[model samples]
Target: MTSMRTLPQSSPTDETPLVALRNLRVGMPAPDGGAPVIVLDGVDLTIAKGEIVGLVGESGSGKSMMALSMIGLVPPPVRVLSGSIKLEGRELIGLPERQWRSTRGGTVGMVFQDPMTGLNPVRSVGALLTESVRRHQRVDNRRALEIAEKALLAVGVPAARERLSAYPHQLSGGLRQRVMIALALVNDPKVIIADEPTTALDATIQAQILDLLRDRLHAAGGLMITHDLGVAADICDRIAVIYHGRIVEEGPTADVLRRPRHPYTAGLLAAVPHFGSRGSRLEPIPGQPPGPTRERAACSFQPRCKHARQACALAPALVASGPERRVACHNPIEEAAR
Candidate 1:
């Protein structure tokens, strides 16, 4: 993985984040009717205005669950047990469905992973985009259609108006992705949560979509959920590493990628196939992640971490490892060691 681009600078105004999650704990009912299964445990994260933060981890690491919780879409049975989610100083935890609906696309928008499945197959592009606009903004049908066309144009879709009549199946994969982005941006929401937005596209298309997002997200803060650290390094100003529902490490992109403190973060960075290191074998992290039902009495990563110590038997709090960086590890890799 070659360096994609110079990392974007963190905002000075980040003192007040656009989205703040503090001690967030989400859980689902246990299979045996015992205790609930924890999906997100005491997660703390913040995304300031005009910055894109990456929420990254392996599958079932609660990345998507966090995103859903923000948009008030966390499915039933899986509940937000305790936590505070503030959007620009407004509380969103117990908002009613009506308020959540208004907040969904008005204040926060989401770009799901699969454009094919995310878009409504029966609806035309015009109808889909216009409906979103009308639902959020007080706009007539004609104005909504105009907004939809303008959004398409903004996303670099050719013949924006003509494309409005086309169905989701009529467009190419790249075009569908563009439409997905356009829909997310149509309302000009303050916070955008893009969950693996480029996963379904090819490399070239993925790069294009990423570029589009970077350009369009300048006004609003973003949370990009992905497993691809390369993509995160390319576009995110900061990166947060979550494991078994806990944020184990977080820092600026360059800092985290160059000199990771947590062993899991280091393992993830090492697993990427670097362009400069040709013929070198990838070093995948050893062992599977703990089951969701497993309790978090001790360090959840102690089983797979080579640097684990007896102290790891007790869970380490996410303490400051460096300026603007936090790592939850009893024996973090020293900066001089790398």
Candidate 2:
């Protein structure tokens, strides 16, 4: 299998990435007007035009926050303290709401975790999808409906035209998810952010959804935010592991999954089930992650890391661990162990 590097050097002719995130820091203001509660800290990532990069992390590790920030929908109270989110060379961090409205579905699209909640229960699927198309493109009602139907067909939804007339409640879970994908793709966006798109589906349906995404995402960059390393391994070219709102490790998918450098990543891999390790018990990470109220200037995983030492009192910068890999750890898992 070939490995795809996420760094700039990997580009064919140093082409600019479709989406670039650098030194991103997002936080919520404290009630006392003191320090802010950080959600995403000094994160750097890039997505090119062709591959899908997976952001893997625990529930509160700020996966969704990163996604929302890119689309300029971080919501009130939680704000981007400092960061750069560039889509196709244009800065998106401080863009006005008016511009963001066009960019959200036109340039970058998002497929949320729950399709049921994502879609309007009262509105027909056609109404929801056509509205997105009409808003982004200067198209009439007939053209918008045609575009909506095409989007559904692109995502493998059967009876695409007829399905559009059905309400969200009328469709099955898989159908609803397919419709959600259609809505995201209807505007022909350059980048797509799929937040656990298969979490609620059965094994068969999940496989089908993944296949559809794989087929359609070849021409567009994708950021797949998932907690399951298994799912990331299946579709992502590279995997970035986030811990405590910071990216602890990032590398080609095969390399990270087979020989994780960060201890937290290793712990996560151990907890997942494998066919060969069927008889063995899974080892969960030892300590609970710090809540939003707790602020840590040092390494957030130190409390649970067995390799932690006095040097870990300060958070390590994400630096090169090996070829095509970076890890934020003073004591990374030795290569010889692999």
Candidate 3:
């Protein structure tokens, strides 16, 4: 793990950030004495109050790891070498486990990608929901149950009262996800981190879940992690494009989507399927992302970038490219086609 270091921040707001992660580096052990396989490298992000920031990237781009770090749930063996996670301007890097446990579901609630993984199979949904609220809020069983029912109803869980005794496997995938969202909201946390909340569901269920999160779930701000840019564009106020553990492009959703500066961003957008486009073939990005253990000196995407040049031999730092756009490329793409 690298040492925690501070970096220059580029935030849209001058006011304090609700959640700020600066110079965060995370990695796993290498075969020998070589550098650790860097999973996250000097990532800086800010989520202001009332803002919904989307963290979009491929499978191994460190999206979920960043979310776990926020909730102090970063899995072991993958250590956070150095960086600062601040909540309301308070540093959380060095917080004791005792304090982190208190902060987990209380200050920051997480809605994982799959409820099947996050939920207990043996326990009834009612028990799972009530347990979450009870952990953060001091309430008796009856009141905890009441909060659970309200939370379920708020998330569109049908027959909320009757569903309490049902096991997670008994409900459909959509219903189970609704319960997860409900559990996350029951605590009324100040911030929410949703890691691919709509991943495994069908199209209809996905839309319904997104609608619920966007319209009903209220909090200080949110960090939504997903591989789908369309989903990000649909719900996020801003989007941060991560490639090889680094944010290659970030800006307002409209700006990034309308005028993507990074070739990687353009590549991702080109892969999306537009509505009413019958018989249209979806363009997929060529080549797979480098493995986690693969080391690189220059641009990680250089091998795949059509516009890569000799200058890219020296890696580029994320720099301001437009009024609200930042891109980390020696030769970034021009504004995206309208």
* Top-TM-score structure, candidate number: 2
Winner on TM-score (2 vs 3): 2
TM-score to true structure, per model: 0.94, 0.94, 0.91
Each prediction's number of clashing residue pairs: 3, 0, 1
Candidate 3 ranges beyond 4 A from true positions: 1-14, 31-33, 216-218, 277-281, 336-338
* Candidate ordering by lDDT (highest first): 1, 2, 3
Q: Pick the candidate with the highest lDDT.
A: 1
Question: Model 3: per-residue lDDT, tens digit, 1-338?
Answer: 13222333333235668888999988886659678988888899988888899999999888988888787777888878899898877778888998998788888888888866777999998998888888888999999999999989989998999999999999999999999888878888779889999998889999999988886433458988999988998999999999999999999998898888888988898888888997888877889998775465788889899889999987799888878778999988864433
Estimate the TM-score for candidate 1: 0.94
* lDDT score at residue 14, model 3, on the 0-100 scale: 51
lDDT of 2 by residue, 1-338 (tens): 13333444334444677888999999998889999999998899988888899999999999999999999888779999998988876789898899999998898889988987889989999999989998999999999999999989888888999998999999988999999988888998999999999998889999999988876665698999999888899999998999999999999999999999999999999989888877899999998987664366799999999889999999999998789899999999997865
Give the worst 10-residue stretch by lDDT in candidate 2.
1-10
Task: Name model 1 segments beyond 4 Å from true.
Answer: 1-15, 30-34
State each model's CA lDDT, in order.
0.90, 0.89, 0.86
Candidate 2 vs candidate 3: the lDDT winner is 2
Which residue pairs show backbone clashes in model 3?
A: 4-82
TM-score of 2: 0.94
Q: Give the TM-score of candidate 3.
A: 0.91
* Candidate 1 CA-lDDT value: 0.90
Error of 1 at 153 (Å): 0.8
